[model samples]
Target: MTRIDLHAHAFSAHTAPKVIATLLTLAHRACPGFAPHGDGTLPDLLRAEAAAGFDRVAVCNIATRPEHHAYMARFLTALRSGAMGEEAARRVIPCVSLHPHDPDAAAHLKTLVALGARMVKLHPYSQNIPLDDPATIRLLALIRDAGLPVLCHTGHDVTAGEDDFAGPRRVVNVLDRVPGLRLICAHCAAWRHPETLDLLLGRPVGVDLAFQPATGVEPIIQRFALEHPLEHLYFGSDWPWASPAEHAARIASWGLPQDRQDALFGANAARLLALP
Candidate 1:
């Protein structure tokens, strides 16, 4: 089966070196003993994913501040224009980010679609915005009208403060408000908050098994597999934070039926992205 990783990240060459260094440092501090499997560059990410047997990886880029919008837009433009080598471009699918505080957030979403972005990634904790804020709701409406899928970083963040920006409760509110929105709640809606799974079940939403370790999450995953439709669950490595190979191996060891495993690894993502 063709394996598609629905969530991953790699720094663009245009990303400031200082910013990259800061992010890497913060990541290490947030998760003690956390070691990245690849350097924070596109080429390195591609190599790591290839080594892990991933056929395609969606690289999620976030803009914490408003200024980052144009820069990321330009980067996506160049990437889609083949400024990056064809092989690298083919393997990496670009997912744009929009800060809820950005005044031109809607415009940037349109720009991403024009540049052939299949989806967008939202990190409310990192971006410091509430998922149910009016501005965010407006943005979701725009995405819905554009017919694009959005992958939201739901649950708590180690680096964040007291605010529950992307918690499952807020996400559920968003879903209730924005009917027909194609949404993917990352990290199984915060594995710690298993109640999120109950809220998400039977909804027209997607959930990715990213950052979930088999040792602790296996039972939860098994329960989800049995209760929820397998078609909405995607396999994601959450690379740099987790190992793609390790996650794939864990999924393989789940002993799920071959077709269910196939759906989790790739087919579900393909259908969501409308990939041929």
Candidate 2:
């Protein structure tokens, strides 16, 4: 099977200004902004993913505000244009997000789905909304009907806690409502292991260890693999946020079985996404 990096990012110069501005604003409210302290552009993230042996990766453009839809759309257009004039752009599979509460978001989402968006990325923390909130519930419904997978950030507190959409419980509600909606719970539901464990075991949700640092959550990840095997878990670099070398090293140091390692690195995501 081909190596597939389920998670990745490609920054578009066309949308950088808006993203930077939003991050600056978020940095004021949310502890960590969209970009890391010193993270570079999409190209920088692409280099890291490539060096880590990822064959292809997904590009997620978030929509936090109603006005952000245009910027997100432009970025996706540039990424999938095959006209970005860069090699990295070709490797990207675009995933666009929409603010569930945005009045016109539903219609815009329909348009994007028709154009070939395979996934929907939602950040309750950045948007300061809960995943189980009415608006989000409706949004999930729309995305589900479109046949797109939803990748939601669950766990930890960059700024807000459970109230801001980092709660796995909220994810559970949405999942319960939309039982058929495919979801990738990012970060192994970091800091919410009990809930994350429950959801994964109870349902067929997939977990990705994207930001597990060498000293961060390696032990727990190793334990989870031992407990559940790799078919239910996926490896993600969460590029621009964590170094690919760091993620690769963790896997190397753990020395998991070859089959399990292969599943974690790519096969699991392919299975979840029903990829080629």
User: Top model by TM-score, which number?
Assistant: 1
lDDT of 1 by residue, 1-276 (tens): 778999987775666355556655765554555556666677877887888899998988877887787877787887887887786678777788877778877787788788887888888877888889988898888888888899988876655655678878888899899999989888766545667767776666788877644225456655555556778888888776677888788777767787778888899988888876
- Candidate 1 residue 88 Cα shift, in angstroms, is 1.9
Residue-level error in angstroms, candidate 1, position 82: 2.0
- Error (Å) of candidate 2 at residue 274 is 4.5
The Cα local distance difference test for each model comes to 0.77, 0.68
Encode model 2's per-residue lDDT on 1-276: one tens digit a residue.
656666655456676556556555644454432344224466766677778777777766667686777776776676667666467566666678888778887788877766667788887877768778898888888888878888887776443434536667777787788878877777766553555666654356766777535225555555655566457677766665566666667765776787877887778777766666
In model 1, the runs with Cα more than 4 Å from the true position are 13-30, 212-218
Evaluate residue 36 in candidate 1 and report its C-alpha lDDT on the 0 to 100 scale. Answer: 60
